[model samples]
Target chain A: MKTIQAVSYPVHFQDKAYKELSSLITKNGYSTIFILVDENTFEHCYPKFIPNLDSEKRIEVIEIESGEINKNIETCIGVWNAITELGGDRKSLLITLGGGVITDLGGFVASCFKRGIDFVNIPTTLLSMVDASVGGKTGVDLGVLKNQIGLFSNPEMVIVDVDFLTTVTEREIKSGMAEIIKYGVTYDIKLFKEIKKNKGLHINDLIFRSIEIKNEVVLQDPKEKNLRKILNFGHTIGHAIESFYLESEDKKNLTHGEAIAIGMVCESYISNKLLNFPETKLNEIKEVVLSIYDRINLLKEDFAGIMELLKHDKKNVNGQVNFVLLNDYENHKLDCKVTEDLIVDSMEFYNF
Target chain B: MKTIQAVSYPVHFQDKAYKELSSLITKNGYSTIFILVDENTFEHCYPKFIPNLDSEKRIEVIEIESGEINKNIETCIGVWNAITELGGDRKSLLITLGGGVITDLGGFVASCFKRGIDFVNIPTTLLSMVDASVGGKTGVDLGVLKNQIGLFSNPEMVIVDVDFLTTVTEREIKSGMAEIIKYGVTYDIKLFKEIKKNKGLHINDLIFRSIEIKNEVVLQDPKEKNLRKILNFGHTIGHAIESFYLESEDKKNLTHGEAIAIGMVCESYISNKLLNFPETKLNEIKEVVLSIYDRINLLKEDFAGIMELLKHDKKNVNGQVNFVLLNDYENHKLDCKVTEDLIVDSMEFYNF
Candidate 1:
């Protein structure tokens, strides 16, 4: 098992991660333990998860409904009230056991419960292991806006057990791959090439590389003031697209990775046009993303709606929509403002 | 104006505080400014507050109902939704201008909105100026529980203007004095003696002294691991009594200071019994508290409810209700456990 000391806590990898969790719980001497899981993880992951913990602490399970819709203030209130009613206190430990939604919502719940309590994350999904679990960013979507209510609170520990991934669907796996691809595009060209060559689903090396890149950026700028904005290369447009589809009555809910995949394609085109990014690399990015994620078609009508959503992006500062454009692999420009015409042109490139 | 650097920011005292606020706002360059106030502050204090702010920043005023009942999750949701709809973003600044309730809830809203934004506290009431604004503790009550959901995120600055306090009622002024008295009991003997000697209502020196003591304790232990628990000397029982009256059908709502004044008397009695606190000092404490806060009559039925509420105190560890008891002036014993029989005896002492 590999252990990476993150900005706030340690991220333990593989089967031995549970051992570390047990030790951490014992060391911290928590009064009680509460495990937060969604319906899917409660069924698919909790059975195996329970046996790994060897602590004699009184443990309680809080199960919320699965999916993004449940990750709101209502769910947080329910969870908080449950913990309070069940006698969970400042010394209680909340272990968030599931995907990004569970981790994000659970972390936010724990962070706010009695002015913050100690919590750990055992991320089940590939997206969470590489991204959500590493960053101390925990929050829930406000209305159609994603991550609009949250805090930068790290968990006591993060246990990344890939064994939980066996039950995850291929679509979910591919969804997580978008972020890995993003890390490669933004910080590591060799990593991009390495992932392209490796066809098998097993990519522990790739996930670790992504986390390392994120942690390095986060360490330099934890508050996303400057260097950390580079991490949002695809997320600004991706989150907007994600929110647009999420709210649309006719459209299917896009997985975070799927939406971000579309976002990467669109933003990469913008980077190519405005920042002299290689046409060949842009083509390569499109091919790789398209092979994994089905192309999301955006009509001229949809462009206005998506752009409207983009304006609400949390990354925007002082009414100016900022984008991180890449001129070359690992040579990224941060906080570059682009016009609406260029954004529409980028969407045209994605549609093509 | 006396300026004290707190754990994360500065606490600016008196008229010069607003100038500091203007400079801080100008220097930071926030996208927008949203001022959070209760009805009382809006009617009584904001007019005086507006003239002090010499900035051209676009400011919006969000007013909630004046009182503790409005400090809940429902109100937080309303405020958050309003901010989202109003196009408030990461760069926006939430300037909380009111008593404890406004500062507490507003600070909490700013902390969680968009995973945290910059906030400043311009405390109108004396209670907030001395205690609430300096601690970096932002939260709202849950059900009957006080400050059950919150975050330990400090504001960018705290501007304590005594000018706003001129409009406050005498009852409200006394409420703020409870915390000032608490600071003297727990940490500073000389300050306590000085307060007892001074008959005047003008307590600028006392307020400054109370904040300095709190800031010193908070700096030593930011997370309340050990030393900071001393700050909760009166708060444990105080919060329960406050919650009890707030929820009681027949009882009138007690101000935070009123509730805590009663708590200090009971806990001080417990200290005398358990830790050999000086009998003369205990009498002095009782006399001073009773003179300021009207004696709250707790019937036999109320004891069971108050004790039940006491068990749920966030200061508890492994189900043991812990407290900070003083045996001598400035000599505090933290995490001391008392039996139910002794707690009842302490209440009996107050009843006597």
Candidate 2:
């Protein structure tokens, strides 16, 4: 029973609230346990993780292959099979241990296992702990789409320990940082400034602030009915760039965070052009980000291709490109609708 | 832009509402569109699916290998790559086109595309339309672990057209029917009785009733915070039984519904033993289910295994073995917190 108190969750970041988990279990006195993990974490994390679990003889560990390709029906067959094989009764508890992949997948698994199950998320990566862990949103990806498949099932408990980030690579750290930065830009200007220095980004501070900002947004709108959509500041272009990279042979060359960093910058330019974000601030944003991220050059041909890609973005409400455009740093978000012309114009900023 | 209305939603069904899809799109003015399908649906149903589709110049179709095994991070990566290669952007609209597997996977994909995306579900099978499509629960399973990896995100709209079920096999129908039957038994007694007296179940009538009953329960508790647990009556023991079949080569294989039928009977006996369900009603319950589902003999050696398996049931509230017991039909659901002795005693009823 590990309990982690996120910074924004503020009071304390304890995993599973040790006393709470034990007391709850004691009160309930349930029979079984289910552990959900992906291929990478099961092999790597479970060796040490299994011994510490209190599931006793009733434990079953279900593992899926790691990556976004397996996040569909076929993988569900594996889950359906595992649940069947494990003889998971309704009384069983599923504990998810992995990165965003595990937390998202585990929550979905628990939600649909007998129409829903009790699940706890033990995120083991910077991205998952900060971004995926707090939000109740869970799901897998579909082809040419991201998170097209999912639900809003909150976990019984979220165990976000920085210890998990220790195993992550520099690239993974950056991917998680993209969202952390988004939080600062969308809502917390001060935090954004702090992270911009890249000074307090020593894993612990980033984790706390990122988690804190997310918790605040999530608390306001558990379901992204409104304000939460503001969090998509950099994600709009980030996702498309990610898709662009993923589709090409250059897939290996790009990371999730790197793409999002590029997205934030592009969208920032769009924000400046469409939503009247001041040029001074826009340049400041560009300067701050360009200093950290290698600027990506786009071919003229790729401009149309990229614009075409942006059309597939899910944020388009009803068909209009609904962007979480920035206004006065952290003061406002304009859900602006951009056309291809404007979109193409925005890409020029990234070329520099 | 196709819509289906099997459950008497406030809106009109397929063709009539397709205009609305276009209207919705036209009104909002979308940028891009992406469709999600599994291997089976892609090959079999896609040709028929595309003509009626709300076409976009920048649209792309993504396909994942069909089957539950493929639903996971790896598959999500495949989707991410497809979306990337296809150049999907934040303005993208994802349409899920398949059975439960496709919708579940696709929904998750859209949700995490760039943290989250807006998508719609076109559930092709009865099981999915009735179960998966409505709930917005999306995810893939871990190897030997059912639905171990996932996220929760609802579609912008749910389109359930029974026309798709035409391609379903009898076995598939039964699998879907298992859930229909559960809804009847647990939530609506009238529906249960309606399903019971069937010289053979009428396709439309039975399916309609099942969906209606399910809709009622779902509407009451959109999220399974409470009240929805009754739906797990048969699933509690049933899931473990299903897993037993999957794990043991010698055990007779059963479809999801068939296993639930067995679980209902055994638990009916348990309900009688623990909660004073009348012997006559218990007998009626068993008779109805046994007649519907063929019997499987349980060896004494399997008792310990089954008992051990109960702990794996993810529905256990805390650590307690929670049972959804019925006092009489669907009128009353008694949440029974049973001890090890009661669970073991109940297993005896399933011994042939």
TM-score of each: 0.98, 0.63
In model 1, where do residues sit more than 4 Å from their true spots? none
Worst 10 residues of 1 chain B by lDDT: B193-202
- For each candidate, what's the DockQ? 0.84, 0.15
How far in Å is the alpha carbon of A44 misplaced in model 2?
A: 20
Q: Give per-candidate clash totals.
A: 2, 130
The alpha-carbon deviation from the true structure for residue B142 of candidate 2, after best TM-score superposition, in angstroms, is 2.8
Summarize candidate 1's per-residue lDDT along A145-209 as a digit string, tens digits: 78889999999988888888897999998888888998888888887887787767457777777
lDDT for each residue of candidate 2 in A240-350, tens digit (9 for 90 to 100): 877776777743546677778887888888888877888887887777776666677766776666666677666654446678887878866656777877777777777
Put down candidate 1 lDDT per residue, B1-352, tens digits, no spaces. Answer: 5799999899998777878888988998887899998888898898988988889988888889988888998999999988877779888999999998999999999999988899999888889888897878999988878889998889999987787889899999989888888888998877777778775835778778888999999999998888888878888888888888888989988998998888898899999988999999999999888777778778888888889999888788778999899988789898888999988888788877
- In the range B251-300, model 2's lDDT, one tens digit per residue, is 65777777777788778878888778788877777777766666677667
Predicted complex 2: CAPRI docking category: incorrect
lDDT of 2 at A107: 78
Model 1 lDDT, full chain set: 0.88
